[model samples]
Target: MKLPLKRLLGIGAIAAIVIVIDQASKFTVRNALAIRETWTPIEALGDYFQIVHWKNTGVAFGLFPGVGWIMPFAGLVFLALIVLFYKPILNGSFSFAIAIGLQLGGAIGNLIDRLNPEIGYVVDFIWIWKYPVFNLADCAVVIGAGILLITLWKSDLAAVKKAQPSESGDAFNKNFNAASAADKTHE
Candidate 1:
């Protein structure tokens, strides 16, 4: 198969996996714990970490609570943008594909929660020391964003390297200038 087609398939697969995992984890959390309920899986880490069934009607990390009504619209816009620019944005890189897939999944996962009539808020369970409760979707988004940044950085570095003249080119230019001067002197 063509590389672009392969990449698209890979991206779709990764996104589907992320969405399934995120949704399944959220479902399990919701069923196992009531809203606001907390469970400490490791007693030794109880002070540092716990699984809490928390709800957020806002963006990631519980920011801007109660503004979730706008999220569905925003998510739709994001999906539209992805559909419009996936080729250029992905740049035919596997890393870029993975990053976009992860982000897409995360966005869709949270959008699903926001759009659900029964549960209009995102279900967050994972919690760390003094940190806001979040879910697998949030983790996927963050990690995907990080990967995207790294991929962009690497691409920029490669471009810069390609733009700069290599040592062999510099040596050839010096030799050509010397030969030209020699011929002019011999004339």
Candidate 2:
């Protein structure tokens, strides 16, 4: 297959996997745990990690509450933007593809909840002692964002390196100028 096509396919595959996993895990959590219920924390980890049943009508980390009604449309727009810019993703590096795929998957996963008015909230279960409860979709989005930052940082670094003149060339020019000055002094 052509390179761009192959890359796109790979991206699609990763996104599908993430979406599936996110949805499945959410389903299992909802089925197994009642809202506001919690399992015992693992003793080895102290309060660091536990499973809890919670729901968020807001954005990630439980922010921006009371906007549940708007999220479905927003999710649609987000997905549309991703589709529109997909060509750029295909042409970019592997890390870019992974980042886009992961973001896409996470968006879709949460979008599913938004679309289901019956649910009205995104199911969240994963908990850390000091942090708000979140779910697989949230995890995917955060990770994807982090990867995107790394990719951009690396790209910028490479560009800077490319724009810089080689040290050897600078040293050669300095030596040549010094030798010419010596010749002029002798003359």
Candidate lDDT values, in order: 0.83, 0.80
Q: Write the per-residue lDDT of candidate 2 for residues 1-187, one digit (tens) a residue.
A: 9978998898788889998999898888889889998876577875688888888888887778877678778778987877787666777788988998898889888888777767768988888888998998889889999998988767655544444344766855554555554334322
Q: Which ten residues in a row have the lowest lDDT in candidate 1?
A: 178-187
Candidate 1 residue-wise lDDT, 1-187, digit = tens = 8777888888888889999999999999999999999999999999999999999988899999988788888888988988887666544477888998999999889888888888889999999999999999999999999998888667655544445345777755554555554334322
User: Against the hidden reference, what TM-scores do the models get?
Assistant: 0.85, 0.82
lDDT of 1: 0.83
Clashes by residue pair, model 2:
none
Total colliding residue pairs, candidate 1: 0
User: Lowest summed-lDDT stretch of 10 residues in model 2?
Assistant: 178-187
Which candidate's TM-score is highest? Answer: 1
